[model samples]
Target chain A: MPLPSSIAALTAALSKLPGIGPRSAERIALHLVQSESGAVSQLADAIVAARVKVHLCTTCGALTEISPCEICASPRRDASLVCVVERPVDILSVDKGGTFHGKFHVLGGKISPLDGVEPEDLRIAELEARLQAEPIQELIIALGTDVEGDATSYYLAKRLARAGLKITRIAHGLPAGTGLEFADELTLSRALEGRRELS
Target chain B: MPLPSSIAALTAALSKLPGIGPRSAERIALHLVQSESGAVSQLADAIVAARVKVHLCTTCGALTEISPCEICASPRRDASLVCVVERPVDILSVDKGGTFHGKFHVLGGKISPLDGVEPEDLRIAELEARLQAEPIQELIIALGTDVEGDATSYYLAKRLARAGLKITRIAHGLPAGTGLEFADELTLSRALEGRRELS
Candidate 1:
């Protein structure tokens, strides 16, 4: 009596993803029918394979097929200078910049008491444990400048500073190529405060 | 050197989907690993299962796990009244409205001479063949209001407006709940022209 159950079901499933509304889900589901026959099959297979095999790295909380992940296993990365991030996605963004030869640690989330998130809710304990076990020297906090990110950075900076480790918050400012007039007051203020003399 | 090859490959694969850029793909791939372990597997399995089994219905062109699709197979639908549409998504949309009790004929595409789309490129032959075999009375065209859709409709109307049967186009106008001031001039003019007398 209803529409072809397969289409209805596929549309329903596609709608569950973030930013995909009903119209978009319908478009995608319909396109799946007419697209390269094997493309959808391969996508499905990839999803299953990724789901079954990928696991969080025990050391840094990054998604990996192996327990330690590739970055953790690499001998070349500086283990002493670890860049701390809020999520695994942040790791890729930092890695893509190709500037940091140091390692990474994903906290999984920020400290947002408003959303019922706390230090205990994140990987704070795991980070502390890693610092204790490894010969870590400097911890770089690469969290966002949002309220929760600010709170988390403050908490980590205070805690790590007390533990006799050098803690540095990644400098926040207007992104490169952004015009000064377009920059918000907070970003302009941060840019001014974090300014360093060019060598 | 990088993340797990499979994780990277999957991220790359997901990026190919509509509206999903590199960043969104990475986030989705990572989200799958960290959250909803069971659902991710289910989605993967469903994707493959649907892809392997689903095909277009020869009668209506809706995607179905079975041939002919449910609507084409249903005797309750008015086989004499066939609604012609551009894509399978339109069929699902009209079906959702629960207004039409007729069957569907999907053209798969519209007539876009500039874009290299012609009547031969669509399922026009199939539609003509169906008219000969079946006792069709009315042919209703419901396509997008784009240039291609208009050209296709005009072409089809000239070709299929036989001596006995009635061929009609769905009325175009302002969408429900939209204000006249906000409506585009063309749409408002069309709405005025298509207005019916209140009995």
Candidate 2:
């Protein structure tokens, strides 16, 4: 016989999660059913709690339990510098390095005309508002170097251009700790062009 | 700032699931938090409902929504034959083939002396009780071909030996659609030894 209908339903719901396919969904569902009841209940509760409690920061658009988020409210962070990213999750990737103490803004998505995404569809207007209200002196666009990323960065640099505000995109070069053989053609060329002579 | 405490909790809970590591768990947590509120709540509800509703069939220890399970209650199944599996989930794997109309019994685990899983720890007593009460004539041991599986199968065969009762194990050979070259030494030897004279 097939799995019990309830287990099947659990598997279907789990399959909706990112990175979990039908086979893995089935395995996890079966495992969860036979696991400790308390652990299963706790997992369910955690899902609901995260969904109900987490919200985007009003100022920076980063995920947070509070309105302004810890980064936006922190006086220790560099308020004059704002790092812009494509998705909210990118904030976590950059912050994990613990080097960037600047504020952040999630652009929601890059300008992908092929997929019908436009600048207006992103959170660009909100970013402009933040720049006007805050003392932001520099905008670090930490986006991919793909076609969409390049187009979006170019458009933003031109549109948000002003007398004082400086705009720059993250460097596109060979990743650290990777061998030269692993670097793709485009990455090698970019690394060559972005080279600087140490005095 | 790091992820909100609620999101962190959700990521931790997700990481505990099988096949999900820290990176994928964080990705899923972020996706779920951004997904529609209705879908997230439905997923949470499905997990709790499945965990609360589904249970092990008391008769065979297979996962079921009811006491006897559909297989045990059905009249169309072959009541005179039973398939013994290592875990409740293994029942699904065998039954999915649709050729096994016989009932099933989950041994909970195989006998592994190295792991301290003795015969007494498994559901052998329950199988014995079923055999005594039911009119079963054959017991098909659907288990892996690992060292533990072979030992358990041999032990069960010797222990359950009786007049008018037959105990057998599933075949060990090259899997269907696989080339002969893919078969390992042990599987090739077993297949060669079990070869029959076709008319």
Instruction: Report the Cα lDDT for residue B44, model 1.
Output: 71
CAPRI band for model 1: acceptable
> Interface root-mean-square deviation for each candidate?
2.4, 0.7
Q: What is the TM-score of each candidate against the true structure?
A: 0.79, 0.93
Residue-level lDDT tens digits of model 2 in A91-162: 989999999999999998999988999889999999999989999999999998988888999999999998
DockQ, every prediction: 0.42, 0.81
Q: Tell the DockQ for candidate 2.
A: 0.81
Question: Candidate 2 at A21: error in angstroms?
Answer: 0.9
Residues B19-127, candidate 1: write the lDDT tens digits: 7788777777777766687788667765655566678788878777777788888899998999999887678788888889999999999988888987899998999
Cα lDDT tens digits, model 2, B63-128, are 999989888888999989999999888888898898889999989898998999999999999999
RMSD of each: 4.1, 2.1
Maximum-lDDT candidate: 2
The list of candidate 1 runs beyond 4 A from truth reads: A112-121, A162-164, A179-199, B65-70, B73-79, B93-101, B110-129, B143-162, B169-199
